[model samples]
Target chain A: MSELWFYILAGMTVAAATGVVMLPNPVHSALSLVATLFLVAIHYASLDAHLVAALQIIVYAGAIMVLFLFVIMLLNLQTDPDESPMNATAAIAAGAALAIAAVLGRVFYAFGTSGAGAELPEGFGTTKALARVLFREHTVAFELTSLLLLVAVVGAVVLAQRDKHDARVEPVEPVEPVETEGQG
Target chain B: MMEPLATPAHYLVLSAIIFCIGALGMVVRRNLIVMFMSVELMLNAANLAFIALANRLGNMDGQTIVFFVMTVAAAEAAIGLAVILALFRNKPTVQADEIGLLKW
Candidate 1:
């Protein structure tokens, strides 16, 4: 029952993932990416990784994607002319990508795609189980990740700040205004 | 409903498919934001492979690492967008091929 669904969901995910890349309009690509991320969350759930799956949806489909949309809005980006599918660069890139995929496929085939996966252990992928390992074994790394996030936030703010004098166009001079009767 | 049970390989192949799409996007796309989106796709593909391999080995380590990957991805996305924003302000363009001053 689940296996068939896996194919269906995976198909949707792949198609949408490709759409995210191929769509000319960034907004449309973003919509497609959200669909892909949602399907990926479902795939995680199917693997019995409920916690990771939830995080996948919350962080990816929810937060990060919203951030992406916000940035897109901030930029007010125009359509890229370089997205032509028939360009020589695109053709070359496609050929190169195909070669890379073929090599990866050969490697995966060498490993054999048959029934080698082990059974899930008791309570694996549960929050409690995952927390135990995360807090106990990987605590240092986890704390470091928090620090990295802080740095990223500060860096983003600093980088995005533009000096008052710096304008995309010439700054209009401040005008001395006549005092309004109420204010006067 | 009852065909041969899906194995790790099935998941692995799916991950590969996503990864390939990501690689194609990164390779061909000109917009910096879209390129970053491709990077996200690749990261998710990595996460999928990690989950499948962890299931295969019956290990918690791989899953734990996925948490770390997500954190890093969030941070990367924030910083990357900021950088892109700065670049756009400077040049009014986000085409990866156009920003070649840093290139050799």
Candidate 2:
């Protein structure tokens, strides 16, 4: 039962991920990415990662995707007409990606026996179990992660903040390249 | 015989496939936002692997690591999107090739 759902979700995930890549329209791509993330969250649940699954939906599919969509709408980005599907870069990237997939697939398949059928502890992937490890043994790293988030928030605000002097500074007289080229 | 259950190997292989797909998207797409989405895809793939391994090993360490990873991914998205916004402000374009002011 779970195995069947896993295969189904995996197929959907791959399809949605493909949409995120191949869709010409930025909005469409973003929507597809949201779909892919949600599907991945389901995969997390099937793995018994309840806490991570919740975070996957709330943090990833919720907040992060919202940020992406806000950026897309803010920029008013449209479909890229110049990028056709059958380009040299696309072909090369496809080949490279296939190679990487093949290598990784082989390596993971080879890791089949060791730790294959080990029984999970009760509440193995629960928030309580994760929190115990996170707050006890990895406490310093956990605290450092909080600091990192604080810094990132501050940095993002600073980087995206509109310059106050831009109104005065931006309207400079246009310099024609023709005269400059002639002088050079 | 086909395994009746989904093993850690299945999840790990799926993770690899997804990660590769993300890499492909990152390379093939010129739009910075789409590339950023691809990066998120890759991160999610890694998280999937972490969860699968944690479950298989009967340990909480893997899940703990995934928690940290999620935090870091959130931070990365915030900062990266801000940088994208800053770039778009000056250039009015999202295509990566269009913004080459620093490429001497």
Q: List the residue pairs that clash in candidate 2.
A: none
Q: How does model 2 fare in lDDT?
A: 0.86
Model 1 per-residue lDDT at B98? 84
Candidate 1 structure quality by residue, lDDT tens digits, B56-95 = 7778888899999999999899899989988888888888
The segments of candidate 2 whose C-alpha lies over 4 angstroms from its true place after superposition are A167-184, B1-5
Candidate 1 backbone collisions, by pair: none
**Against the hidden reference, what TM-scores do the models get?**
0.87, 0.90
Q: How well docked is model 1, in DockQ terms? A: 0.51
Candidate 1 lDDT for residue A135? 97
Query: Which consecutive 10 residues in model 1 chain B have the weakest lDDT in total?
Result: B1-10
lDDT of 2 by residue, A79-157 (tens): 8788675798799989999999999988976775464467777767777888888888999998899899999999999
Instruction: Kindly list the per-residue Cα lDDT of model 2 for residues B1-104, writing each as its tens digit.
Output: 12224887888998999999999988888899989999998998998888878767778888888888989999999999999999988888998888888899
Segments in model 1 whose C-alpha atoms lie over 4 Å from true places: A109-116, A164-184, B1-5, B102-104
Task: Give the root-mean-square deviation of each candidate in angstroms.
Answer: 5.6, 8.1
Write candidate 1's Cα lDDT for A91-177 as tens digits. Answer: 888788777767775665455355565666789889988999999999999899889999999988988888546653353533223
Per-prediction DockQ comes to: 0.51, 0.51
